[model samples]
Target: MLLKELVDTAATVAATRSRLTKVEALADLLRRLPADEIAPAVGFLVGRARQGRVGVGWRQLSSVMGEPADAPTLTVADLDALLDRLLTTAGSGSAALRSTALRDLTSRATADEQDFVGRVLIGEMRTGALEGVLLDAVARAADAPGDAVRRAAMLTGDLGETARLALVDGPDAVAAVGLQVGRPVLPMLASTAADPASALEVTGEASVEWKLDGARIQVHRRGDDVHVYTRSLADITHRVPEVVDVVRSLAVDDVILDGETLSLDEDGAPRPFQDTMSRFGADAPRETLLRPWFFDVLHVDGRDLLDEPLSARLAELERVAAEHRIPGEVTADPAVAERVSREALAAGHEGIVVKGVDAPYAAGRRGKSWVKVKPVHTYDLVVLACEWGSGRRQGWLSNLHLGALDPQGEYGEPGGYVMVGKTFKGLTDELLRWQTEHFQSIETRRTAHVVHVEPTTVVEIALDGVQRSSRYPGGIALRFARVKGYRDDKRPQDADTVGALRALLPGA
Candidate 1:
């Protein structure tokens, strides 16, 4: 497909405010694309190189600049050298320099590169601005039903492939392809039931399994080799070696198991979510210190259980886990989960996830089929000066007049104490006392009502609820928000942005 064709499609989607218009535009593009150009066509739609998901990093625009430290100093020096030129010179401020840069960028950049630039300038990078909406567009373009495209994309996670089947084969193409061997199925997740009655109504006669407080992992083992992926499907096999050992110990020669990877303390209780997340950072040791507990199996020996009922799959999971002594379960009773949750909380672990006993793996979604009920506490808050945050928050100072940023946006705007928010929920009382002293130093003005600070100090802010408010411009107000502590490790510009504040939608 031509680059202009894809650009037009993306631009059309972005310009159209309604979902209906976006879908129609996307479908129109798909219908017009030649069959042979399907893969490239989707590539155009994504404004990315045509590469498999497993190999997307090198295809990334920034990745084209080169690896960190090794990356170019003045300009992006690799495949994105052209892009670097556009970005570096795009902001000369000097009209002549700006004109030259724009001219050069126009001549040097590809059609897709132009689209990327347009999106970056506008702060909307992903195709159609939303993945779900775009996926629907791809289906419509192919003249296929949305369900078919959703299933294909969910199973494969390859928008390009999904686009292909949706365009050419229409809906039902996924089912017609027979079972995909080696292709991973999307894993299922848990949801929360408003109450026990609702939970029971949905479960019917099915069983409920306790959702453990741990990271979700997809375990793939074939023969003696094993691979593990995080919920985002990032390859983490090397980071969690203990999981590999467990899979190797499994009875089946080749099996794909769905489960959780959690850091269990010495007392056998899960650790903090932050701790679990931090374990796989850039600085984490490339060793298997994490533990993985198996819960379900979606594939075994090339046979797909995706269409199979949970009851049958549970039997398989039970047999394999038991035969191999892998940590997993098959019983639907909530008692085991209740015990797990109680024990987990006693040991400072997060609450449990209750899963459906018969649901197929519904990857890329969160619904009642899989339920999660975590215990979160709330605190009361007092409104301070509200300012904009950075990046997406440049004009609004959206960050809470946060007591803190790394500076959570408590900077002094011209007329008032404009700050985003502040927080260091990890700190102790000692930190809070230290923050008050530091905040006093930055004080520019003070009143009986509000103490105007220089925005130099930031204190951590924590709250439980948000209510509609005339107090804030975003049409909402914070509840139980106050300084938990402070973080001096960050700068004020590094504070939260207005975008973050908007994310606190009630239902969301």
Candidate 2:
């Protein structure tokens, strides 16, 4: 199919708020695509490249200028092949070569197609539909159950390939997709509750495990061969050899373990979240070592435990890798849940995750089968600035720039606010209108995208925790932060200090 046809379909999907309409439009587009073109088309429509990050930065894309074609000629396969070539050319003069390639490719696309291609290349193709909606659309187009498509996508770890299978080879082929020993399956996620007792109430009989403040890893092992992936399913086996070695040493010949990994201090306590990230994010190994703690086993001894309940999976995990299992116990009593939560918090860990004993794994989703209970930390922070909104939020100041007071002037002037993070979540339309009108009164300066305001307005912000960072002046960044409400009664001096924010850092 022509690139313009896909681009037009994407526009239609974005224009509709009704999910059914979006699914119909996408399904129609998928039906028109050739079997070989289905995977690339699905990837492109979902704002992803089939080959992952193509090493093409914004600078390279913007550097090459090409005139739009008057007719539709670029096919989905054509662009995919062009990207494949671009990925191969590297080293000296590779930039010029890539630029030429991009120019040649763009010159063949019409104006709308060019816009779509540019957005796809830069990772800016934000339509309402992503993987979830597209997965449903694939099922609709193939006349298959949604669960079948979801399971195939999760097990294979590739929605694009799953789309091709469902559209081309039929439902029987989609059902055939299963766990491979060395390929990571999507990690199951948890929804949040107020506390352990509250979570246990929701899950009935449950296992309360210590929720560590670290990276989530899915390890797949087949004898000596082992592969590790992040929560987002990016392969990081090269960066974490120790993890690979540990998985390889497991008694089971083939197993897929879902767990957490973090660095521990000399005292055996978990290191700061940043310290673990410092090692995990590095291209080369750091002095800090990562220890794996398994909570659930997806596959064991070539038997798939993903369809099995949590209790069965835990039993399998104990028999296989009991030495590496996370601390927890199974109980229906809320009192027991509370005690476990206390133990987890006292150990300097984040909190407890109460999981249903009878619940099977629900991968690629945050379902109610499990609930995470963590203490909420709220602070009164000063408003540093606000940024212009986009799409539905246009004409309103949507994203807030939050800063913590620095009383000691450790990172800035005494009594001045130091930048910490930005958040656009938990804001209502009324709140946006209020911000746009109120912030302008204290405006110190203005830019195309942002309005600098006097750090006088204090707002109540709630965050999960803080992580060490070089991006902020205070050397820490807020995690999962959102506005609770404007603290109109509070002054800038009454705002929380940077030290107070840093104190929330886990294992700090």
**Leading candidate by lDDT:** 2
Q: Write the per-residue lDDT of candidate 2 for residues 57-86, one digit (tens) a residue.
A: 445665674788999999988888987888
Q: Give the residue spans of candidate 2 off by over 4 A.
A: 377-508
Candidate 2: give its CA RMSD in angstroms: 12.4
Candidate 2 is scored at a TM of 0.77
TM-score of each: 0.64, 0.77
* Stretches of model 1 off by over 4 angstroms after superposition: 34-115, 118-129, 168-174, 177-181, 194-198, 283-288, 323-340, 377-424, 427-463, 470-474, 478-508
- lDDT by residue (1-508, candidate 1, tens digit) is 4445556567677565567887788777777777656655555445443431211111133323222232212211222333334445534464455445444444444645444543332222344435566687786666666776777777785677777776777667754643343455556655554333345456543444445555677888878878887765667777777778988887788788888776767776666544565566555664325777777788888787877877777788888885432332333445555555565466665455555666766666656666554454222122243332245333322223542111111222211223233333343444334444444433444554344444433333556645665554445555666553333322232334443444455665
Model 1: which ten-residue window has the lowest total lDDT?
406-415
Go through the candidates in order and give the C-alpha RMSD of each one to the true structure.
Answer: 11.2, 12.4
